[model samples]
Target: MGMVLVSHSQARVRTHDKCAPLLPLPMMLQRNVLSDSAPILLSILLLFQNLTISSNQSDGSDGEVLLKFKASLDNPAALDTWAGPTAPCSGWKGVLCGQGRVWGLQLEGMGLHGAIDVETLAQLPGLRSLSFKNNDFEGALPNLTRHRSLKTVYLSNNKFSGEISDWAFSGMNSLKKLHLENNKFSGTIPATLTTAPRLIELALQDNVFEGEIPNFEQEGLKNFNVSNNRLVGQIPRSLSRLDASSFSGNDDLCGEPLEACPANYDGPTKYDYHDDRIRHHKFPETTIAVVAILLGAALIALLGVCIFLICRKKKSHQETAPAATAAAAAAPATEDLNQMERGGESAAPGGSEGGKPSVRLLTFLKEDSEKFDMQELLRASAEVLGGGVFGSTYKAGLNGKKMVVKRFKHMNQVSKEEFNEHMRRLGRMSHRNVQPIVAFYYKKEEKLLVTAFAENVSLAARLHGNQMSDHQSLDWTTRLKIVKGVAKGLLYLHNELPSLTPAHGHLKASNVLLDAAFTPLLTDYGLIPIINKEQAEESMVAYKSPEYKETGKLTKKTDVWCFGYLILEILTRKDSGVEQQADVDLATWVETAVANESSGYVAGAAVFDQEMAGGRHSQVEMMKLLRIGLSCCEADVEKRPEMKDVAEKVEEIKEREFDDDFYSSYASESDMLSSRGLSEDFRSINI
Candidate 1:
């Protein structure tokens, strides 16, 4: 719709039709002001501007703009609080207000998705910060370059894919702290991102970026990461001082903080080199003696080079000769690998060759898993599931069954034979509580793991994403079952894969899936062997264990400590995404909350999810479970109970209504105090 204009002196200003693009008010007024009969109209327009400015706030224009923006999301209910007559600055959720206007929208993990309406956001002239971190928003980012006034932008942990246009960040002058980590955004990182004069803290990890990095000149840049991507070439010198973890997960990247680049390497260069400059230089062969001397020196140098090459080749051959036999069963013939890369549709999923191994690169680990060839998987219609610290995950359909394909960028910790052997070992695991590996694909740049999709989604989604939807929140019984099952799964992993450190290395709510019956099954297990050491240390939940964090030590109890964090999340229904600056996790929060317990279980009750807190016995059971969790999470590592003990404690605590006689699982109050550091706070409360 076009803007309306009225002139007391014979109104004749033409208005564009609805289909036409709207022009800025100044441009619209300029067209009318320059007209032959417009001196009177121009003077009246000035009076109109004055009147418009006065009614702006009362007109509810900014709130209306946000409403339209909310409507554009696939799940608008995520922002239900953004509705109504209440001023956006006063009551709307996530709308940051200052100086009586909307300046920021900090929506994180509200389960919102779909492309945002950039035009609607543009209406708020005072807008500065925009955060959509940990949401499900997909598609290429909006035309956000126009939002030059923006300071910080967080699109991390979303499904936004494809290469951003080079001009996308060209006009973002005020930009800083751009976090596009944990997404499927591909192609070379936009060089125009350097245009932002205030740029800092650029996080581009867990993506599909390729080619050389841009020469970032911003002096203020402190936090940066391009790890877990398809990036190649030397990192920019400006970012070399950062920890090696920042550049992990990229196999081809080289230079300081990593390995040294080749001496003749021309950075970001596409052409082949052919150097012959030495031939053009004139030799100072003024005398026959000088010529003879030069000839003798050249001959001696050539002889030395030949001797070194012969020795190196002999040494390399001796070393590799033994590896050849050991690696024989690990990979297929070179021809077979080339054929697979060429998308040879000659073979079906399990059609003899998908199983063809370093011993089969495209091995179907499970005998019963549905088969598809390399070509089929490559061509399958896929949906982005989510991006994690490891890499991007997708839901792909094959043979009428849904399968999850998780891409990992840094599964290069071991040789190909060792990797295949480890995958086989993990595949043989047949536990009820563990998610089975359906199939796997191996390539130099990345690796893919496939498994059956769980219908109930992840435990994290049940506890968080669907809380506002029609889906009911998981009650105490279900939460208890999940933790029990997770504990059982850990027990199996430890018993079956005794060699693997912590057995289940990446335990978290998101990694735990729920079946139709609400049974918890663990996935992404035993991956510490393949993950890059630096990356695993930096991002994996197991690495966040108390002993590892404090002393750079990893014990058998490291996974138990991670399990404790999971218990805290399930009980409290609260989890802090790493994106948050506070860095306080659920375990720490529970520790602090329970530490301040006064009178009785009053403080401890506050830590549990309000929905699940009720019934005298249930409260007691929660306290008991809280104790178990804290004990498993104990910082001493020595005090933490074994997985068998933890599982037994969980099993001992059952629903109070069914059992005629209920008793505390521990031997005595003093026993609980000694077992867990968090138990002392609850001693005053008689449960």
Candidate 2:
């Protein structure tokens, strides 16, 4: 089953460490007076002395239990990180722990299959949460009632077939959320849901459950979705308050949120409003009587509305001018790149491909750039580099210069004057770490921004590209240089866009364009004010901040979180896609890989990218940066360091010089490389 989210509430296990410490001073003073009590004191000391040792051994057992579970999987590579000696409570993926004991396992989207050994799981004493979402689990589930402490169970988006027995959840008294969506469960929603008093969220959508929904009476069941099932009959009164969509896709299910359920049926077989005589009309006689009067009154009202509309026509047009310019300016403002896909340019001056209107020469921000008008742009040969939620980007060869044209929609939240003012502010930005806005064209509906074409690929390509190419994997020093540049660029944006929600609303590895020298240039900065706020939240990286999800607000620390994600991606040579088979949220994955609370140290060949390994000194510096990255990715915005402080932290990680022979032994010969936005590729042969 595919799960969207998972959480675990944990109560710390009171480890037996609180046994009376060896307070020898107190005993020494009382030794002479309490000499007669020596036998009792010796027994007490021995009992406590053995208790701590047993607690340590128990903690280690949790790892053994998880390793056995991993061994049972059909594809063990999914749990490769679980193979190491790292304690399950310390750093193993999907293993959640608190107070040095495992309490939960979040194994969603791990591409897992095979029998889930319920007996093995019962070995865990306090395990409270289990999310097996988006896996390949098939056939009947094991007797989960054996482990009754389970609280949140997510088994959504799986191939598990057959009806769930009513006794499946029989003793899960602590259960709070149960999701079985996108499966083949039949018969009916488990009747045992009513037994769990604390149940709050239940999702049974997209399943084969039938025979009417169970009457769920839990007052705390605030979230329930049973849509797209074989449910029939009236929705239970207890669930009538749920949204209409929750009952959609069930053709037979009807009531309050849907149409009234046939009004007890057989009330009337047929009716006809087209009948000429009132007797032929199946509707009431009074309804026919009022029809003539209503039509007369409606005619008189229509005459009044026409006169009123005529009087207000002049003022209405005046008011609408600011909301929109000439409609002929075109609504398809994001097709400049699509023109290239058609195999040739539109001969029309303003790119007739999308009906874009011809304006004068565009506003140029740089003093030395050769100014070109709409006519020249329409004639240039262009190729689309990329397209996303904002719009399409085109790499155009215009007047012998390589230029990148970026088209954007949904920038009309502000008036034309204010939009131009924001563009001007962006143009004034002049840092090497920041992508310069060379020119811009603004309309009431959309915008076109231009900049110098980047000769190298984006950081995302360098990091994730699967093609065989020289310098596919980066070295330590090069990665350090890219992230340091990123930090500095972020600091500059924070200073410049002090009023913005997030200084760079779309900061991501793909958004960071690297120059030939592998220098990071932050793109798409400070547009939160102009972009449609709803779309930005859905599509931009800034809203990925944990606080935004919890509070529906954005802050400068959102940029910090994005930067932290980039740092972790660089260190792990991984992407940040949440559902990618080979990757997870880089920050969360890193935290799990090295959460060594017992030792306060995470150093092994597994923690860093094996290809990026330099001398041991390099690992020390990488550790410092990793710590800083984790700090930036903190869930609490207040805990995240200020962007200024983060910049200083990055700058302080000095990559010191080592002896020539020692450096050559561990470091790559190609120390410098062309920038790929996600990773910089330095080819030794080219150097």
Which tens-of-lDDT digit does each residue in 386-461 have in candidate 1? 7877777777677787878787888877767557656876787788899999888777667788899998889989
- Model 1, residue 503: distance off in Å is 0.8
Cα TM-score per model: 0.46, 0.46
RMSD, every candidate, angstroms: 27.7, 23.1
Model 1's C-alpha root-mean-square deviation from the true structure amounts to 27.7
lDDT of 1: 0.73
Off by over 4 Å in 1: 1-361, 467-470, 576-583, 598-603, 656-675, 678-687
Worst 10 residues of 2 by lDDT: 678-687
